[model samples]
Target chain A: MTRATLLTITAPTGTPAEGDAGFALADFDAPQVRITDLSVTRGDGVFETIAVIDGHPQALEPHLARLAHSAQLLDLPEPAAAVWREAVAAGVRDYRERNGEAGSGELFAKLIYTRGVEGSGRPSGWIFVDEGEDFSAQRRGIRVVTLDRGLRHDVAESAPWLLAGAKTLSYAVNRAAQREAVRRGADDVIFLSSDGYALEGPTSNVILLADGVVRTPQTDQGILAGTTQAAVFAFFEERGLATEYREITADELRDADALWLVSSVRMAAPVTDLDGREYPVDAELTAELNRYLLSRTE
Target chain B: MTRATLLTITAPTGTPAEGDAGFALADFDAPQVRITDLSVTRGDGVFETIAVIDGHPQALEPHLARLAHSAQLLDLPEPAAAVWREAVAAGVRDYRERNGEAGSGELFAKLIYTRGVEGSGRPSGWIFVDEGEDFSAQRRGIRVVTLDRGLRHDVAESAPWLLAGAKTLSYAVNRAAQREAVRRGADDVIFLSSDGYALEGPTSNVILLADGVVRTPQTDQGILAGTTQAAVFAFFEERGLATEYREITADELRDADALWLVSSVRMAAPVTDLDGREYPVDAELTAELNRYLLSRTE
Candidate 1:
């Protein structure tokens, strides 16, 4: 009989998981926390996906800044900066020990922060690390489907008090939307808010095209102002391309010269198809953005 | 120096927390689980609250029946009968161990059924033993505020793909609305669906009075049909009083004869004030309804 090896790490000291004294162990190969312990309460928490580059997290500072902003939106306690830095460092360490360096392909690090524990205040959180898909897919661009199954941006805009831009744990709906898209034989989905407004993609950022200008949803549209989205805007500005962040209707998407889904993993995957309509992939622009992202990380 | 004693519980098998693990524990005091471990992704859970009568959960059967109906709505795996028995047994056990038969006053019991673990394929769930509240405030009635927040009922109705009428985990907005209400010096809130239709209360059942008839928000409004509200309906029906479950407007609430909030904990808390407007408390009907609920529990 073969025995499986386990890797574990002690949960953060102040976390309620630490309250379970018996389950605490000292190791690093397996996760110390188990998924079953989660309850179905409001599931309010903040999370961020960091890129691991050359045994270190790329753009770590910006991710943390967004995480903090999201925590504030959710009314959750902000973990100490040192604690977040340490968690990210630990994840990077694990990645390096297990998979060597960033040259061995890109690693997607996910940091989850939640607070639903007994002693852990209502703002308890967790940080996790993960490796993203290889850049091979983005090398040839990707296909996408526009889905209208999620919340509308306007209603979400009206009720600004809720966790609008925050990366809360109430992500089951988002994940379900992605699953629906994948089920439809597409690589990803760009959610159209309930009112037929083009929102962001399920897990990635969104950018559209209209009348020779690059456009994306306004930040106030309840879409997460993604880090990669910001980088794209910056690149567009530096290159002197007219970048606009405004409300783009589904009708506008049909006439746009090009559309792309941007994220840390893919940098920018030009949309080849949307809602059964196909657009010519902008390979040259995609390569330029990917090169810019890689130049920063490398 | 005196030390404060902290009460905690751990799973019997010392299992680590699992994501999507919804139901399993029957006892809160046996050190089985933590509350925050529950998330909203599990659609197969239902809860009931009853006036603890003689150290026991009241209206256990009806509450169980409603829970079974809810589980069915979410396509839960457990049959109504089995889930009810487990809930009753757990409630009884919890009361016996935590509150004890010798105690007076009142207690509250909650039964939550969740789709346990990601792969169990069978819905996992549980019964929670907790404390109830004092009803002195209800006698005086309450001050409520009105707000139209998040997804309105019509949008939810159109988006039938989203879980409707299931006491699922997506309650962050609901709880936040309640918090906002309390912050504004109101005891509770009556949500106006996006279409300007009056909906239900956050934690309590809704009751509206107009034309000498007692009417509550329709179940089709996508509100969790309150078990206590149902009992009140039955009470009024037997007494030859007019009762209904239908669509109502906020304008209707202003002109209604009386509006009350119902729940297992508070029974029926009358709306004495709404949005700066005051209404006389209906003590006569409240007393009658209280008697009816007590009689049913007995």
Candidate 2:
């Protein structure tokens, strides 16, 4: 295993593998995909990133469910959850066993399933487990800016063809928005719909704290349902605070007492400033949330 | 070469190659891209497809210029046009030589330039020349349906981060619209902006003729500036017809005397029916236009 452990899904769908793990480990550093793969040529694919803490993949079931939902949205064949589940476990175990003490801390397993090479009528999938970037600075706090997502919040229901909420690989616009955020002297971005409603970030969900209650933009509004956000809500509920999901206006988001962008790998990163407005970061509470997030075994 | 000729651009940019074509012939069957390449993972890339007819690549310079323009929109390093131009020629020649008499008809050279493997500053470039699908039935006529693009027409100017006109690999939305069209009993689609303005098709440009004037939706409205549409205008201009570029409403498009979906591979595909309404197919005129389009030498 050269730094990372990679596996190509031999049986992405159909009956689960009994003796086998439904995948075959392959070279991680060598070229592994054809130039004509739809994922590369047309961005026709779905993906998920699962954070592995001490050989345990956090939110594994939710991530797999979202992957199936996204595949259905793209008209792709539903991936076999059992196969992917086993593949993720095998990938994490392989990476940990090969890296000795180096990989015991934090790692991410990325699962990519795509419409295969053109005209082949077959799908392709793979899982790669490797160390993730250090989010220490961003995990503490980061500056944020609001950018237009260029689609109405209702597009998910009105025009499903836009693939608003799917975790597809066609993320060029989302990547561009982050670049724009950097250009504007901010470290992150929260996208606002064309109809003037707060959505999610490029890769995370937005959460707000106000008036002793916690709120997040609903998943129906052309935004992804974050896996880490579920855990965050569980944290707040355990602390006796109320949590809700609804359509949030930009003005309401601005008036929140505290805010954070939560995702699978980075967990929770408190927002220190949104646009030009400053907010007080709840350092102690955020630290506790991250600590709880890292301690999840299943 | 195996059904196609593939070339890897070893030096995609910088000083142009003198002794070499700036590319190397590669195996078309082998996997050529890493799993982490941004093109596969994030759809962070731009591409262009040029038509090749009997050893001649039509509108090569214009296609290269558009490719450069799209790269600029994505903030990618400008591709050395001279290097790509030579690569296309080599790829076409190689394909023809390998296929002999079988490749005398129509071929396409697809130029793909991507933000290379993750964490590596180097970009990736490749060209593949292959025979296109037979378009005899589609050339006669295609049934089209209007679908919402879910973006305002002015997003190209107002929200550059949307990457509306850049022709990036993030084309899943466009692909989904075509699938939706098929579901609606149509063979193709013409996307309408959220503001009710006529826009381009999923893989082609929409051209309309009415009252002796040839018109197309202006490219500034978040639509690709079409290379084939330019040649279509030239065909009409030679026959003493005026051509115009302006924002066209959906009603105007529906009432046109004639319409076509022009593209690189298919050239000119006449539209006979739109949204259950019928238009008389001008087979002779469409055939003449395609002949002229195929006759371009440069």
Candidate 3:
């Protein structure tokens, strides 16, 4: 008798991850399939980047919870948690298998759950995984550009009814701004809203320096509330360093003592420059946050 | 001497063949390796969607011209035109061999020129040919939702940036908005600026109702300016009906006599409903435009 050869890819010892966070190509059969599927095929979806440390995806629960909220805001079906945990665990496993060791460097875990595949004739959803960039710059800090690409802020307040808090993909504009910043010889971009307010970074989280307290845009600014940003803020609160969330103008960012682009991937990187001018950082805070994060990981 | 036989098995075409537009996907065993070989993988890329009609890709010249313009905008190194024409022709020939008879529906030919795929380690551009929606409703019309989905007008005007016009694969937000509308039981969506000013539809073109005149948002409104929308405008002008491009508001749309969603695939479909309210159409004007489009195509 022929033996039944079964290939069983056991579920990893974790939860299924979900988001429009990972990468996929834009190839779909029917164009309308994209409309109906509302999947990532049209390259329109928002995502958040989270860091994986040791054997665990850092801030996994908060990230997943926020992803659910984002999906709901975007009017997509809330993906089951088992699927999300599995997807993320798979990503972590794949990273460990190929890279062989977690090392001191972080492993990036992006949980991409698109709405559907184009012309797949199926209700769309897929979990994708990929490696992320080297965020060593977080330790050393990085240069950035404050670009007046004329993004608007009042639109967020007036049209709070829109997908303000949802991290939907339509990011070609953000990517373009980053490229424009690169063309101007900057490493990253900070988009300036039309009213001269400082918006978020292209892909990183945002924090600013005003007076003495560190402040970032409130959740209502239509910005994706970053898990890392939230985590770091909690860390600050524990340390008794005051932090605030409020509207900030470009002048504030330009004149602040220090500005950090925070994210799960970036952790926190101080911006040393904006446009063509340079801004010096307060070295004490940089070391303080890095130490706090490293200690927490330990 | 033994003759070498060439194997010609069936390939699943992504879309139906029409005007020589069709496509089939081929998987690479080691996608990571192939990406390095294909120069088109550059993340910053541009594309043009051309319609295929009656075994011939209509608007070939215009499509290529637009491709060149998009390439220039992205600073992509353009391959020779002769090479492009030949590549497109080969794609068409392959489609013709498979479909057997002339196709009755619209075919969408997408030419992708990219900077390079991230981590693909390849230098390649991709050509995606697929089919699209059959606008059987153009003979009737469509229902649409006017949504203030947080798009801004000034940002589109002052910067007039590339992402606003370039047909990039980064379309997650546009797709998300459409899905949001769908959940609300609408067929499609038209985005309004945060200020309640009209922008454009998610994928289709835009034409607004007015004092017995058909108007579209100025190209400055960051609309894609569909070829069909242009054709309808030309037809109206030829018939001595006034057509103009200017700013429009949601209130204006509600006050107009009729509205339309236009595209290359659907041609023009009257928007019979906005939000949940019913909108009546002018049977006479709808018929006149339909006749004009048919005659022009013939």
Candidate 4:
């Protein structure tokens, strides 16, 4: 498989020249952030990963909007969306030129903006593009375990400093939870708030289908609003399917007719098992949802 | 001020050469980690900051032990302490040889180990040495505000995946708490558990003196074990001063005869105000404690 990485460093004054904007993985070998950069040292940054198909980003507007919200939550300077869009386009163009048309294969386009090195007053922003992998093996199904996120569902309303809904780079706990799930022979983790409310997965949104209705936890419960999940909900609604965003319990999740973890890259992955208990899989629905997600771009 | 930065990268097979062991801030201008590096994308890493005085690192062993503990908590491989020691030595040697003896001026020695670029099977580890500034201005005194950490004191015990005590690179919340404190006209913050128990500061441990006895919160309350605070407690104990480690309340902290935030670099900084309420300042005790900390080395 061919892999490519494109980086465009936006300086304090101007963006990179067009000739200097193409793809190269070797350009990333050297040191980029200062040791004092808060993003590297403290993870004080926000990011978004968009799926690109045929050189077009899926849900570009929504991803940019979410990135802006995350930046606001982090007290970081709002990124210039136009600059990011241009960089993403340049990256996609470079990737296709080098690795051929994306076609069925996809690219993960990432936008990262970090509170730069201390006292420099310049935020370090860049776009990175890489080949997306086939999730068919995972889409065949995944098993997930429930882990305690250790935060009350109502904390985000009162404690904004917790950064509950922001997609900051401070993901050590999430990564550790995923590791714990793998240790328990599961593929992913669904976090439960300390108060027993179902929260979210380590890196994706959790959704359940029951009695012809689709449901997910409310975002006000200190969870990031999932872009892919939003898109899927809209698609389902357009097709005359019922959808609801409300409080979900672990018991309800276990009793659901079907469960799936949704993300931008993987689109939608069916949950075959939960805590060693097998669930009924609706292969037809899963495939249809995947097809809709992969083929639709907004 | 003469500033220097020394980086030593440990490759998959071998470490960098001696000639590449010195300090240069310009060496950090380039990209260090791949965009796919979990350290960059997910903040899946652990780090330590050691204080260096006149080419001698203070409490190096304790810092390394804590770093190992953090790595273990994150399920990362235990870093080779001897290699880190060698790298630190080289950095200090280079700093002193280039910028002359540190004397009273200090150096901040940082050790970082990331999960590395994805799928590379290699961990990115480096030791960075930089000049530390005089914090006499901040150490003279600081104003702090109480903020909710948004977690119960027992959360760490209930959910190990939260990594409450590990000093991972995921410190965005900590940074946000500090920023909020500053916005509230304070210099720092003292985090309180959701249950109203006085926890530690964003980057330091809180210590209070009441009726001639020194006290700090117990580490079991989801707070990092403070290496400097432990050293200070030992020094005070050796001098026949009373000390205790137990649960502390915000009210007790507000009503304390004196309070201080202790850390590796700043040592002990008196907290003059909490939530706009002034506390008594014992200058003689503060100086004596600083003298003991600065004069003693392990």
Q: Pick the TM-score winner.
A: 2
- On TM-score, the stronger of 2 and 4 is 2
Model 4 lDDT tens row, A113-162: 78887778787776777878888877779999999888888777889999
Q: If the candidates were sorted by their lDDT against the true structure, best first, what order would they fall in?
A: 2, 4, 1, 3
Candidate 2 lDDT, A1-298, residue by residue in tens: 3399999998887664587767989898888899899998899999999999988999999999999999999999999998999899999989988999977988999999998889998899999999888898898999999999989999999999999999999999988999999999999999999999999999999999988899999999988888899999999999999999999999999999999999999999999999999999888999999999989988
Candidate 3 lDDT tens digits, A68-140:
7776765556656665665667655654665554323455555444444444432333332334566666556
Q: Would candidate 2 be rated incorrect, acceptable, medium or high by CAPRI criteria?
A: high
lDDT of 1 by residue, B205-292 (tens): 6788788798887888678778788888888888888898888887997788788888887778888999989988868878878877
**Model 1 vs truth, CA RMSD:** 6.3
State the lDDT of candidate 3 residue by residue for B1-298, as single tens digits.
1111111111111222454323233331112112111121112455566666654565666667666665555555553454455556555555556555533345555565544434443223444444555566655867778776554665544554435655665565566667667777778888877677787887777787678687998876666656778788888888778998988888887777778887655567888888867778877878778766644432
Top-lDDT structure, candidate number: 2
Instruction: Return the TM-score for each candidate structure.
Output: 0.79, 0.98, 0.78, 0.94
lDDT of residue B169 for candidate 1: 52
Docking class of 4: medium
Q: What is the lDDT of residue B186 in candidate 1?
A: 90
Interface RMSD of 3: 8.4
RMSD of each: 6.3, 1.4, 8.0, 2.9
Note the B-chain TM-score for every model.
0.79, 0.98, 0.77, 0.92
In terms of docking quality, how is candidate 3 classified?
acceptable
